[model samples]
Target: MKIKQLKVRNFRLLDNMVLNIEEDITLIVGKNNTGKTSMFEAINIFVKTQEISFEDFSQSTYFIFNRLLRLINQVDFNSISERRKEIVEKVIQNQMPKVQLFIEVEYDVTNDSLINLSEFITDLDENRNDATILISYESNNSLSLLFSFLNREKQEISLIRWLKDNIKAFYQTKCFAVDKDSDFKKDIDLSFKSKIEKIVSFEDIKASRTLDDTKSDKNKTLATGFSHYYRERDQTKEDIKKLEETLTNVSIVLKGEYEKVLKDVISDLNNFGVSTPITIPQIEIDSEFNSESVIKNNIKYYYKHESINLPESYNGLGYSNLIFMVLELTSFIERFKNSSEEKKSEFLTILIEEPEAHMHPQMQQVFIKQITKKINKAREEGINIQLIITTHSSHIIAEAGIDLDKGFDRIRYFNKIDGRLEISDFNNFRHKESDKETFRFLKQYLNLHKCDIFFADKVIMVEGVTEKMLLPIMINNVANSLNNEYISILEVGGAYTQKFKELLHFIKVKTLIITDIDSVDGNGEECKTDFANAETCNSTLKDWIPKKNTIDELINCNEEEKFDTEFIRVAFQIAEHSNTYVGRSLEESIINKNLIFFKSEYTKDAINKKVKSLFTLINQHSSENLLIKTPWDLRPKSSSSKTNFSFDLMTFDEKETGLNWEVPLYIKEGLEWLAGICMVNISEK
Candidate 1:
């Protein structure tokens, strides 16, 4: 049964709170002292006492009062001469806080029905009112009919006979009832001697303990003896079964890691130097089970070696908090298999607290991957498990996208608004969650060059930040200070967009790409080039070039190859023609000084000179035309000249500059100009 809704009135830190739970795994996240745990306690009490009346849940009326007394911190009840007065004061003062629990459960009436055999017995209650509401055919539920109250009949009756035979209350809570003489606390304890007598397994185990009183004696008796062989065989079989169980669990965890959180988790791990090769060696999982089953209510556990050996409290609270996680999951799997189609229980709900404590950044991410993997696995298996977790893991929060509401069923946060427990759904476009700040910063500033002054309309996705920051400006100023039309220099987050841009483009977001002139492994880093400089580089047969940063160092190398490299030449040229330098060093101050020099008589001369310098030093030197063709919709770079270059930017203006101004820097006036008139398109029938 799925939880439709929950309400708590004066329960723990809760003061009349209600939450409508979604059918999917709903994560309940909040900080300390915010009533997250209290909600779970309310559910537990609600389920255990569902059949009882709301008034009977109070502390004053019956044996249920004992629980209330204990809650008031009263332990020993010894020398109290004023018992009745104290009890009255306690009852009036505490009063169990008046808890009312409501549950809406829909049962499958096609199979078994809830039979309250209690109703048939008439002698016990002459008043004949229903002490409980039990449904037979549940879909169209109606409260069971009641008269007044059941009273004992002077004559033998059906109630007496039935109570003597067929009914057994497996578990029950106490309630006050008016009786023939005095109120009674319904006694439910029964001796289990009959049932326990036939259970010989524990007795046999005890006997075996004696026969094996001395391990040495048992060993002697079993060695090369009939007993030894059988005992050894039993152990071998048990070990084999244990091994198989480990293998099965391994497959489950691995499938979750690889199939569910694959992309995100793998990418995060890459930052920690964990790659395919090292990952291969670490796949050996050391698992342990709670091999003991003393009361037969034993917990079956299988833990990873890293988790077991961890100084858990100190190192990874995320992993330790996860201990109960697998336990709850294993229990749910077992319960689902044994549940009747008609008698399903909502006990499958999982409540986790602070799944993000003390974990290293990478582990925080890894934990989310692991958890989502489990969620996916359960969903695929058709198990109706509702997961409610509280996390302090920022990585967990950040990785959850701002538009997470689309991907996730629901995402809510708990914070106090006017001194009350308040929750608000995300304002996705605002990107204000505690964890998404970095994501917004990167997606906004880093990916989309959002500077205040001198921003460009066109963006070129490049490999690194230095490339991202300097590429567009350098290209404009160095390539002849012309195409400064809202240029945005974007770092693709990586070389591969993972085909995510298919959506961005569908929205008509335009971007130019200037990759390593070598395919990346694919963080957008090109393979090492043999060329000494951009001049000698043959990027025609390669996908990457030396990074501009590395190129600067190479350009500054020993004067034996004295030459003005792109940066150097660009710096010196701008310096040569500037009125007042803008940078700290003359080298840096050059760019802002002279846009006129590059725009005028010197544009061709400067371009040809840089081109020759680039050609000379590239080991497999690429010609000028080839290098320029890639980032632009220009020539086939493999050709010898600029003969086939399309739309030469030698005279391209801001309007014709191939830049995207969708966000951060540019307004879309330039882009919408090409959308043509909307005059023809009409709303469809």
Candidate 2:
């Protein structure tokens, strides 16, 4: 049996959250303060402690209680009718805020043993194999008693303060077994604790581990683990006998040495105590040893490299942390294996928080890659172990791969939207039948690139290396507010930018896609921007945003039509210089906006040869007007290196090289919009 899902209500930031568990490993990833720790604590509270407090309640739930209090305070109880009084009492009973957890377990009826899960199953259907357990902390006090307490203290203290102080007096925790199909709940007696323990065993390795290297340290070490393992495992009679004999012989030798060392003192004490015929006093020395004590206090772990031997503390923290985690995991698995036959749990859950705390990227990748092998090794001992890892490491995520059936589907993304926790399961990311190849390519690309867009506040998908290298400088110049936020700039090019549409929507991050117009004429031949009957060859333009193919339609499209959603906006080349002409690509757009800068004699040797040649051609064509009738006529050809052109721009400075230039109008507008949205989001959070 395995835990299929977990639902939590009114618990801290996880006001109403449902988490679907993977069969073997579930990876929970997110930014800070998004309730990753709260989910861990919720499981710890319900399964291990069963303790609830006022601080555990969500802030939203607290406001709910305050509203209920106001409703009660406004009513005049003495003048109320019988029906009205009943309704008020019923509302008070039903509307009280409570923290709850629902654990759903799935079992195999035909092949698996039901010894641990049989008690929780109430359905008689032969096809059913699922059971749910509801654990809740609710008020147990009567309304009359609560009202009396409130009246006595209403004027003495504020209602919220009073409630905080008296919460434990009225609240209690209860457990029930719920039927899967009928939704009928049966109260499991106190024995429910044992039953639940037998169904699942939980172990948490918290982030803040004590890894002190001093001699006085009392943390878990390999030496201590050995003692624990020895105690838990059965020892043969022959081994016990041999150990006892060795200890006895050592004790005898130590006793003789102690007597010889204290011989002078013993004689003086005997002489001082003896008096004539009275019994003489004797000073005796004894040496005794307990095997367990000797092993626990005397043993130490060491690392041997060639001819050198050093203590475990002598190693660096990265290796120490890795070794410590392996030891802890091994101990947990061994403890499960040694449990009694009838009381053994069906599944062992190990929750590890931030395993990359003290490790480098390579070590983190190794840990993620090896975890599966370790778990499978444990299964060889007839133990079922389910692992949940909460991490902020992109390296680990990248190494896990993004295959729908085996990789990225195991990821659970936790995000906060409008001050409420939201969870997006990658397993639910889907695509149409025609987009299967696109999905496959995306998975491969993400795995190879190690993209951290999953954790960014906003995303900018650019067309090429030119945009990737120069966009930062543009943002700093025009949209400085975005510089302070976590923005991921990805160079997905125009062809594949639309492929990430579903993923961006799934994570719900604000996105700005910057691409080119790629104008073409009839017969699908590339043409200038002002050519007759021009149409866009860019897939993102024709199929994604605006959904227009004609150049005239696209140029006249309103700003609102460019937005795919409130969170996504697409920007491309547009008309410039009071709508005199339009540019087709980024290079052409740049030259159009900074015509004088390119025409200056100072920039003749500072720019790429192909770009300089294009500028010369445009200047030659427009000698009289100094403004080309068609800007796209002098566009750079496909042979020109855009990356080298961008590199040339990188070598100049506004103050030193007289290379001041403005961002294209479309990109600037998109950046400003993204900055405003992100700033508002940050303020709300």
lDDT of candidate 1 over 1-685, digit per residue (tens):
3445555555455565666555544555444456666666555544432332322222222333334434433533354457754774455344433454333222222331323212211235444322221111111100010000023343354332422231122113322211223333232122222211111001000101112223233222211122222222333467757755775687677766665556665556555545444542222233333222211222222234664642212323344334434433444455454545444432355655555554577776676667667767876776555666555444555443222344322444454333466554332323334335433443444222322111122334544443344433345333333252444444554334222232222212233333332222224443322223322122311212222333334333332221122111011111122232212211112212322221222112434443232212222234444333222222123322322111222232334222211111111111222122111222221
After superposing all C-alphas onto the true structure, candidate 2 shows an RMSD in angstroms of 5.7
Pick the lDDT winner.
Answer: 2
| Alpha carbon lDDT of each predicted model | 0.35, 0.78
True lDDT of residue 120, candidate 2:
81
Tens-digit lDDT string for candidate 2 (1-685): 7889989999999999999998888888876788988888998998786588888988887677777777887888899999998999888877888898889998888767887787788788888789899888888853753575567745777656777778888888888888756759888786666789889998888998667565545553656656655555444558866886898899999999999999998888788746567767576889997676666677776789789887766666777677777767777887788778876888899999989888998998888778878898887766778898888787877876354567478889998887988899977876624477877877777777735777777889988888888888889878998888888888887888888888877788888999988889898987777889899999999998879999888888887788876778888888775555677888788767776676554433455332332244333444444344444554455534566557656666567545677788888888998898333222110
Candidate 1: lDDT over CA atoms? 0.35
**lDDT (0-100) at residue 199 of candidate 2?**
91
Q: TM-scores across all candidates?
A: 0.31, 0.83
Task: Give the 10-residue window scoring lowest on summed lDDT in candidate 2.
Answer: 676-685
RMSD of 1: 26.7
| Count of backbone collisions in candidate 1 | 37
